[model samples]
Target: MPAHDLGPTDPAVTVPEITASVPTGPPPAWAVLQRRLFDELDGAWRTFRDRYTEPDGRLRFRGTIDDRDGADDFYEAFFNWPALYRLGGADDLLPAVKLHWEAVTRQLTELGLFHHEFERGYDWFHQGEALLMFYGICAADPADQRFRERAIRFAEQYLPQSPTGNYAPRIKAIRAPHNGSDGPRPGLGPQWDDRFGGEQSTMRPYGLPLHDVPGVAEWNDLADEELAVRMGHHMRDRLGRGDTAVNLAVTALVVNAWLYDHDPRLASWVREYVDAWRERSHAAGAMPDNVGLSGTVGEYHDGRWFGGHYGWTWPHGVHSVGAAALVGAISAGIVEGDADRLDLARRPLDQVWEQRRTGLPSDPEATRRPGWAHTLGPGDGPPVNTLPTRLGLDGWFDHQPAQVAYWTWLWWFGMRQEDRARLEALRDHSGYDWTVVHAFRDKEEAGHEPPWLAYLDGVNPDYPEQALRMALAQVAHRTALMAADEKGADGKRTHETGADDGLDLHKWQRLNPVVTEVLTQLTTGAPQTLYNGGLPLARVRYDDLDAARPGLPPDVAALVEHLDANGTTVELVNLGSSRTRRLRLLAGGFGEHLITTVHWNAAGGAYPGDSRDHHLPAGDEVARSAPVQDNTIHLTLPPGRRIRIRLDMRLNARQFAHHTSPTTSRRP
Candidate 1:
C-alpha cells in the first residue's frame, strides 16, 4: 500500500507539547498543585528506573504470571509506564525505553496479539495503552516516524471493526475476558485460566482498545471538518450510546476534538453521555461502582469485588475519572466559546467530593464494613474471614490507582479550580503509599491484593522489600516509555494512546503500591484507626486580622487575609450559643477558587451547623476569583457558620471599558 494511504506515520505526527506559554492570566490553583504532582511523578519515575532497568535497557518483572501470555504482568507495567511519561517529561530515559518497547512489541507479535482468558489481550485495552505509551514517546522524542505511523494505521484498521459488526456481540467478553479459549486459533493467542469470568463481569467495553482506536481516525479527519463531524456523530451513536462504554469513548472523542480545535458538538456528546451514565449509576442512596443506563449493575455493584474494596472501584475511578477528564479537556477546548463543559466536568467531581465528605467508602469496602474480604472474585462464595484476607487498603478495595492518575492529569491539564480542589480532596483522602509491602499469605489467602496491586509487583510474589523495589521500578519503566518514540505526520502519533491512557496507568501504580504497603502494615499490626473517613483538607487559614472591620469585601479576602494574619477568622460570632449557630458565606464571589481554611469558634464543640463547630475539619484552602470578565467573587464561610452574603457581584465601569457599544448611547 502507498505510504500516504497507510495513514500518518508516528514520527510525522507531533504529540502536543506542553507549551511554555500555558494559558495565561492568574494560573488556576489546580495548575499550581499539578506542578507539585508533576515533580513527585518525575521523582517516582527516576526511582523506578534506578531500581529496575539493567545497564543494557532490559526490564524485569517481579510479579507472578499465572498465564503464559503474562497479560496481567504486562498490563500492570503498561499502566505505570504511561503515567511516568505523561506527568514527568522523559528527557533522560530514551535508550532503555526503546529497548523495552521493542521487547514488548516483539512479544505481542510472537504471541499473535495479547489473547488471555477468552479473547482478552493487548489487542483490546492494553493495545490502546501501548499505543498511547508509544505515541507519547514519539511526541517527546519525535525521532521515529515508523512508530507513529504504525500506531495510526493500527487505529484506522482496528477501531471501526472492533466495535461494530462481529465485535459488537463480543463487547462484554472483550472487557473482562477471564475464561480462556478451548482450542488453538490462528490469529488468537494462547488460552489463560479464567479469573474474573472474562468480559461477563466487566462493565465498560470501550475501556479496552476498542474505545481508543477511533482516536486516530478523528485526528486524521480534523482537517476535513465535515468528516470530523460525521466521525464524531458515528462515535456518539456507537460507543457513546452505551452506558458502560460511553465514558471512555466520549473521553477519547473529546480529546480528538480538542486536538483538532473543533466546536461544541463533540463536547456535547461527552456531557450528555456522562450525565446519562451518572443518573443510571446512582442507586436509591448510593452510587454504584459501575452501572449501565439500562440499570445493569455488574460485578462492581458493591465495589469490593476486586480486593479490600476500600477506595474507588473501576466504574467510580476509571469511568468517572475518564468522564471528568474528558469534560475538563472539552471545557478548556471551548473556553473561548461555551461554558457548559465546565459545568459538566464539575458535576461528577462534586459528587466525588460529596461522597468523600459523607465518610462513605467510595467502593464496596464500606459495604463489607467492619468485616472485609481479601480474595479476588464475586462475593457469592462463603466469606473467608482471616488475617491476610481481612486486611484492606485503598488499592485492594477501590480504584485509587486509576483515580490518582485521573486526578493528577486533570490538575496538570488545568481543570476548573473547584473541580481540581475536589479531586485534590479525593487524593488526600485516598491514603496513598509510595512503597510496596510483602504478603505473607498463600496465593488464595492473599485475597484481592495481588491482581489489584499487580501494576506494582508485576508477576513477582508479594515480598515487602521486593514489592517496594518493583513499585519504584515502575517509575523508571514509565520514564523510559515516555522517551522512546516521536510524533508522526499528525501532531500526535496516530496509534498512540491519549493523555487518559497514561493517567490510568499512573493512578493504578501509585494507588496499588500504597495499598500493598498499607495492607502489609495492617498485617503487621498497623493501627486500624488510621483509616480516617474524611477527605484531605487543603488549609486556608484566616489569621492576622486587622480587626473584624465590616467594610471588608464580604469575600474570601476578608476570610483569607484574616486567617493569614490572626491564624483564624470568625464568619459569625454572635449566634446564640444555646441553639448552635450556623453561618453562611456566599461562595458566589469565590468563583472557581478553592477554600482550604476556615477557623471559627464553635460554642457547641463543633456541633453540626455551629460556626464555632468544625464539623469538617479544614485542611487546605484554595480560592480563585471569578474570571475578571465575569465580574464575580467567591465567598467561603467557616464550615458551620451562617452569614448572609450575596452570590452576585457588581463589575466596575472600567471592567467594560474594553468593549465598544454596538450603538451610541442615547444620552450621549
Candidate 2:
C-alpha cells in the first residue's frame, strides 16, 4: 500500500470560486426579529456536553437518555455538530470533538460500530446510528479508517439473509433480529450474560448499567422485566413500523450508510421503505407518527410513555421527524435521483408549517375522536408509555429552531423559484429569516458568559484560573481530519485540503453524504419560527412564502456587485444601524479552502488585508479554525452605510487541474 498523494496538473475545468447576494437590507421589525437563537442553542449544547460528556468525550449521563451506552455521544455528535459548529463560529473544541470521535469507534461493541445496549451488549435497534456516525466521518474525514472497515463487514450483518448467509440484494425489507431473524454474517459476538437471554427485550433501560452485559450485583429488578414486557409488546406491534417518526429516523440512519458506500441490498430496502413512507404520508394528508407494515396507521403507545411530555406528541419529536426526513430526502435524492420521494417530502413539510401536525389522519370511522380534536398518533397509542413526556407533557411544546432552519436553508440551495414561493407563507410564521442564527456561526460575538465551567467547579468551586485552563482546553489542539479522495499524479494539482490548493461548493457538496460540512456552517436565518414538528431540513415549500425575509440587519444594506473571476465583490451599507459594533455576512454556502484573503473597505482596502477586515488565509494555522471550515466573512461595517468589500479566493484549482467533471470525467 502506498501513501495518498495530493497533486494538481490541469486547471482549466475547475468551476471557479464565485458567490453573491442580491441588493438587500434588514426589514422592519414586523418583517423579522433578531433573536439570538444560535447563542441560546449553543449554550444548551455546551451545557449538555459539560453535563453529560466526559472530559474524554464519551457520554456520562448515568441513567438518562439511551446514552447508557457510548453510542449516545456519536448520535449527538452526528446530529448536533452542524448547529454547534455554527454557534461556536465553526471554531469547535477540536480536541474534544476528535477525542470523542475516536472514543466512539474504540468502544463500538461486537455488533460493529454501534455501542452495546445499556442492559444488553447488542441490539439492532441501535445499529443504524453507528453506521451514520462512522460514514459521516468517512465523508468528512475520509483519511481515517478506524471503524470504516469494521462498518463494511456489517453489510451482511443485518441483511434479510437465509441461514446459509446468502447476502444479496432482494425485494424485501430486513426484519429486526429480535424476531428470530438471523443471518450467517459471522456468528453473533459474545453473549456476555443472560441479558440477551431472549431477543424480545433488547431495548431495556439502565439496569445493570447496560443492556449488553448485566451486572451481578444488579438485583434482578423484576419490575424492569415488567416494563420490558410492556415496551417489547408495544414495539413488537410496531417492528419497523414505517410510519412513526422514530421509525422514520431509524430508516434515515440506514439510508445514510448506503450513501457512503452503496450496498445494493441496503439500497433496495431503503428505496422500498421510502416509497412506502411517501405513499402513506400522501394518502393520509400528513406524516404519520406510527404506521403498520401495510402502510396503514397503527396504534400509538401512550401506555408505554407512562405519561411523559416526550415521544412523537412533543415538539422535539416533530423537529426530529423533520430533521430525519430532511436528511433522508436530500441524501436519497442525490444518491438515487429520488424525485418522487423528494416531492413527497415537501408535501408533509407544508402541513408542518401551516397545520402544525404530522400524524396522518386516523380513518374518520375507524377510531372515535371529536371533530375538533385531532389524532396525535395511529390507533390511539399503546396502553403503556415509554418516555418522561407522558408523565409531564401538557399544552403545546416548541423546541429550538436551529434544526428546522438548518435543513431549510440547505434546501434553498437546491430549490426552484416557484417552489421557493411556497415558502413565502412561512416568512413570519415564527420571525426567522434563516440568516441570524446561521450567520453567527460565521461571526464573532463577544461578551457572552460560559457557565459550563461552573459544572467543573461545584465539586469544591475551583478558582477562575482553573476555569481559564478549562476554557483553554476547549480550544482545538489538532488540525482538521482532511483526506484526499485521490492523490495527485503526473504533476496534477493536489486536493489535500490542509495544504490548500482549494475545493469549491460544488466539489465540497460532492464529497459528503448528507449536507456537506461547508454547507452546514452556511445555515443562517430568521424565519417566522425555527420550530418544526419533525424532519431534518423541512422538505416543503410554502407557495406564498415571503422572499424579502433574510433581509439585511436593521442598520445595514448590501449589494452583490460581482461573482465571476472578479473574486466575490459586494457592497455593504449600514442602513445606519452602526452603533458601531460588528458586521457579519450570512455565508453558510461559501468555500473554506477556496478563500485566500478577504478585504473590506472599512479597512481602507489595505494589502494582505486588515485585522478589521477579518481576512483569514487558507490552510494556515489561524486559517484552519473549524469556524472558517464552516463559513463566515466578518468585518467592521463603517458608520456611513457603504463600501465595496473584495474577497480573493483560490478557486477550485486542484480539482480541475487534477480531476475532471462529469462532462469531462467519468463517474460510475
Candidate 3:
C-alpha cells in the first residue's frame, strides 16, 4: 500500500504544475516517423480488413482446413489486431477485432475444432498462438462482459478437478499435452482424414517423430504404408497422452484470467503448475521436456523424457521448451510477486549455455552442422558463441548463439545486476553489432532486440531512428506482399479455402503491416510482449485524454530515452500544427507500477521562485515535482511543444489490471 501512499488525499504532498517546452525547430525525425508508421498502419489495416473479411469481419474461406489441424493458424493471422487497436490504430479497429474473434470462434466451433469458444483439444504450442488474439481482446476491452466471461471460462477448463479433466490435482500438472474444452484428445493420428490417417506429407519435413519404428531407419523408409502406420502407432502410444513442457504456456492463460478478477484459484493454478515443473527440472538435472500421466518424468517413452510431443527431440527442441519455461516463469512471477520463479526458465538456459561451444564448427559450410542456420552475426565476422538448441538421445546438438528472446525477457522480468551482466555478456559474445538494425522479422515479428537493448544501454544513440525506419520498411514489404495475393471478385485478395498445404495459413501474419515493436520499445520502455502468450508489462503507458482511450494521442509521439532502477526518462512531442492535446501517462501497462514523482523542465519564470510547493526555481529553468494519484500524471501539450518527463517509478509495485483504477481484489 505504500506504493500508493502519496495519494492526492494526503495533505503533505503537493500537486506539481506541468508546462511544455515550446521549441522553434523542425520536428525530430523519430517523431515524424512515429506518426508516419501509425498512418501507414491505418491504411494497412483497412486493406487487410477489406481484402480478407466479409461485412461482419469473418474470413471469406469456404471450409475448414481439411486433413490438418489449423484452428490456431486462423486465429494467429489477426491475433495482434487488438494490440494495434490498443496502440492507437483506429477507432473502428476495436469493434472490428471483436467481430473477427466472434466470427472465428463461431466458425471453428462449427468445424468441431472448438467447444465453449475455446480449442477442443490441441497442443499448447498451437493453443498459445491461438489465444494471443483472445488475450489481446481482453486487454483491449476488459470491461466487456463477454471477454470477461470467456477469460474465466477458458481458464477454468485447465483447473484441477475441473470437469474438463485437463488437469490432475494430485500430480499438479496438466493431464496431457493435447487438451482443452473437450479434454485430452485420444490419439496423435488425424481424425478428420482417411488418407494416411493424417497428412504425412505435411509433417514429412520434420521427418519421423520416432524414426526407429521397426524397419524404419530413414525418413524415406516411412513411405511404405506399413512403416508409416507403425510410426503413427508409435507416436500415438508415446505422445498421445502426457504432460509436455510446452504445456507450461497455459499458465499465461490462467494468469490472464486472474488479471481480470484476481481469482485465487487462477493464481494458485499458475503457482502450482510452474512449481511442479521446477521440481521436475531439479530432479531430472535439466528441465525434462515430458512428464507422464502418473507424474513420472518419462512414463511413456521408455523412461526418456525428451521425445514427447513438441518436446526436445523431433522438431524445434529447446526452442519450444525454453519459450514455454519463460512464459510459465513470468506468469508465476506475476501471480506470486517472486522474481525467483524465473529460475524455472533460468535453470534450462544455464544448462544449455554450459553445453555451448566456442569458435567455428569444423565444417562451417555444412548445413547439418550443429551451428548451421542460427543468426550469430555477419558471415565474415569473428566466431560467435554457440549453445545447444536441441537435446536428443544422441546428446546435445543443433547449436546456435544463445537466443536473445530468452535473455531479453529474463532481464526485463528480473531487472537485477546479474541479469544485466548476463545480458551484456551475451551481447558482447553474440558476434553481431548491437547498433545495427536488421529488417528481418521472426515468427513473433520481432528480432531487433539487440539494437533495442543497445539503445536502452546508451550504446546505440541512433537506434530509435534506425529501428523505426526498419519498421517502416517492414510495413512496406508486407503491403507489397498483400498486393500480390490473388484478387477476388471485390478486387481484394481472396482467402484460400480447404487447402492443407499451409502455404496460405500464415497469410495474416505475412501480410499484417502493423508494426508496433519499435513504438512499444521506444515509448513504453518495454520489449514487445512475448509473441506467443505474455501479459503486457511496461515501465509506462499512455492514454489519450482528448479521445478518452488508451495509446498516444493523434499526431503525438513519445520516446523513452533511458530507464534505471528507480526512474525512466521520456520525451513527449506534439507534432500537430495546432490544437493543444491532453494526455495521461500511466505507470505500467496495467497501472501496476507506482510513480512516486514526476520531474519536468520549464522555461524561465514559468513558476514563482518563492513558491513553497513542489515547483522550485533553479536558475534559468524551473524544476517541478508532481504527486501522482492512482498511478497517473496528466500532461497538456500545446502545438509545436516538446516536453521531457523524468518519472521516478516503482516497478511492479502493485496488482495489475486493464483499467487505471482497478476494482479487482488481489490475494497478495
Candidate 4:
C-alpha cells in the first residue's frame, strides 16, 4: 500500500551513489552541537575525491552530482569547495580546485565558454557564473600559487582582450562571449552573428509578467540608437527587454568575484547592468523580475516583466534575491561604493521586510503556488520551496538547494534590522539543510525506512515532508527526463509528462522550453539534487554552538552575527553613551571556533586576505590560528564605538568525538 522504498537503500529505488564514510557516532551533546565546518568541508572534498574521480583525474557525471561535466555542475561544485587553505590553512582543496579548473577548460569550445552541451558551444550566463565561482574559490587563498595562477588564467580567457567572444564589445553586455559549436558560419568570424534558432541565446531573458502592470510605461526610446551603435543586441528583433533570476543572480556573482580579485571592469559592467535595472525599479517602484534594455520598465504590451523558467514568478524572486543581497553586501560599508547600488538591491528586500511586517514574504495573492512565492522565510525555517526554482540557467537543466541557499544566505547579509533579525533566527537553513538532513539521517541511523515516506502518506502530520518531497521530486523528474528522450514532430529535442508526475518520453515539447521544463518536474518521480546546503548539516551542529559573545561590557551588545565563508562576522552595537575601550568576547562553545585566530574585518580588505596575522593595536596576531588556551578574544572599539570582527578558523588536530564535558546527554 505504501508508495515504494520509503526507507534508505531499497534495492528498488534508484539514487545517485553517495559514497562517503558516514561518521556514525552518537557524539557528545556538546560535540554534536559543534560543526567542524572545516572538517565537513574537507570531508566534502574527500567525498568528491573518492567518489567522483577516475585515476586519470577525469571527473564523471551522467546526470548525477560530482559529474562536474557541465557548467551547472562546475558552478555548484565550486560554490562548496576550499574552506581551509583559502580561509584558514588546510590547503587540501587547492589541488582539487586546480585540477577541476583545468578540466573545465577542456569543455570550452570556440565560444571560449562552458555549458552543459559542449557541442552547443556556449551558455552565456552559466559561462560567467562558473567563471566567477572558480575565481572566488581560487582567490580565497592568495597564498596558493596554483589557485592564484588558475584564477588569472580563467580571467584572461573569460575577459579576453581578443574580439572573438559572444560578450558585447562594450562595457555592459549581459551575453557571455560565446560562439556556436561549429565555431562560426563561413563568412563571419568568432563573434556571434545575426542568426535565429541555432545555438544563439536570446538576451533580456527576464521573468515575464503574466498580467498587465497598469501605471508602468515603457520609457526607453533608444532602440534606433542601440541598433545604430550595435552593442549586445542579439541578432533578433527587440521591441522590449528584461532580466531573469539566472542572469541577475549570476551577474551578481560575477561582479562580486571580479571585485574579490580587484578587477574593476567586470564589476563595473555588473554595475552598469544593475544601473539599467535600477532605473526600471525606480519607475515601477516594485522591482519587476525583468525590464527593458534601455533601463526602462513597463514596456512590453504583454506584461511588466519577461518570461522564462524564472518567469516573473517564484524562480524570478528566488534568483533576484542574490543580486539584491550583493547591493547591500557591497554597501555593508566593507567596500567603497555608492550607497545607491545597495539601495537598488535592497528594493526587493525592503518589499520582503514590509511583507514580513504584515504577513510572510509569500505572495498571499499568488494563485499558482503560495510556497514558491515567498523569497526566503528564516534560516530557522524550512527550505523556501513555495515552488521549485529552476535552472535552465544550466544548459542540460536541473535544480538544487545549494544554489537557493547561496543566494538566500548572501541576501541575509543585506537584510535591514528587522529583516536581518528574522533571517538570523533561521540561520541554519532549516528547510534545505537542517530539515531534510535531519529527516534523512535520523531515520537512517535508527534503521528505519525513509521517515519521510510516513509523512508523505499523511501518517506523520508534523513532519516537513512537503518540502522534502518537493526537493526529491525535483531530482527525480530531472533524472526521468534525462533517461527519457523526447523528439518533436520535426525531431527537435523534446519531453513528455508522466502520469506519476515523472518525466515521460513522449509529450510534445512546449513552445516555450522553459514552460516544458517546469511541467516535467511538477509531473515527475522521486527528484534529484546535486548538492544540498543541508547535506553537510548532518556533520554540522544542530544547536547554536557558540552562545552570544559573552562578557561584553554592559554598554556593548552583540548586535549582528553570522558565519561567512571563512569565519564568524560579528557586529557589536554600543547602546550606552560612553565607549568601552576594549570588549572581551567569551569565545567558547564554537566547535572549532574557540581555537581560531581573530582579525578585525574592517582591517582586512576581504576574507582570506583578512585572515593573516593581525597586530594593529588590536588582538595578538598568531602566525596561524590555534586552540585557544583561554576562550576569549579582546577587541579595541573603533572611533564610532561600533566594530565588526572575523574569527577566522584554521585546521588543527582532527576534532575529537567529545568536545564538551561528557555528562550532557545527546539530543538534536
Best by TM-score: 3
| Model 4 lDDT per residue over 348-434, tens place | 544443332122233333332322222232333433323323222211111222223332333333324544443443333324322
- lDDT over C-alpha atoms for residue 202 of model 3: 53
- Ten-residue stretch with the least lDDT total in model 1: 527-536
Q: Deviation in angstroms for 439 in model 4?
A: 4.3
RMSD of each: 20.9, 18.1, 5.5, 19.2
Across 413-487, the per-residue lDDT of candidate 1 in tens digits comes to: 232465556544553454332223332221111222323232222332333334334334433454544443233
Q: After superposition, how far is residue 140 of candidate 2 from its true place, in Å?
A: 2.5
Error of 1 at 432 (Å): 14
**Candidate 1, lDDT over the whole model:** 0.29
Candidate 3 or 2, higher TM-score: 3
Best by lDDT: 3
Candidate 3, run of 10 with poorest lDDT: 1-10
List the candidates ranked by TM-score, beginning with the highest. 3, 4, 2, 1
Which parts of model 1 are misplaced by more than 4 Å? Answer: 1-58, 61-92, 111-132, 157-250, 253-339, 342-345, 356-668
| Ranked by lDDT, top first | 3, 2, 4, 1
Q: Comparing 1 and 2 by lDDT, which wins? A: 2
Backbone-clash count (model 3): 0
**TM-score, per-candidate, Cα-based:** 0.35, 0.43, 0.89, 0.43
lDDT of 3 at 617: 40
TM-score, prediction 1: 0.35
lDDT by residue for model 2 over 1-668, one digit each (tens)? 11111221123423222122211233322111111222233343454455335676654322222222334334434343432332222234323455666654444443243322211222323333333343333333323354445434443343445342322233232222221113312212323222222332432222222111222233244347554343334333333222343333334444434543556766666566566656656666655544433324533333232111112442234434454455445444433532335654565455444534223223232111222112122244322111111111243233212123433433442444444454443333323222221111101111111121121113212222232232222221100111333345455433322233332212321222111122121122111111111112211110000111112333443333333332455554444433432333423121111444565423322224456756442221111111121123443443443445555543321111101111121111
Query: What lDDT does each candidate get?
Result: 0.29, 0.32, 0.75, 0.32
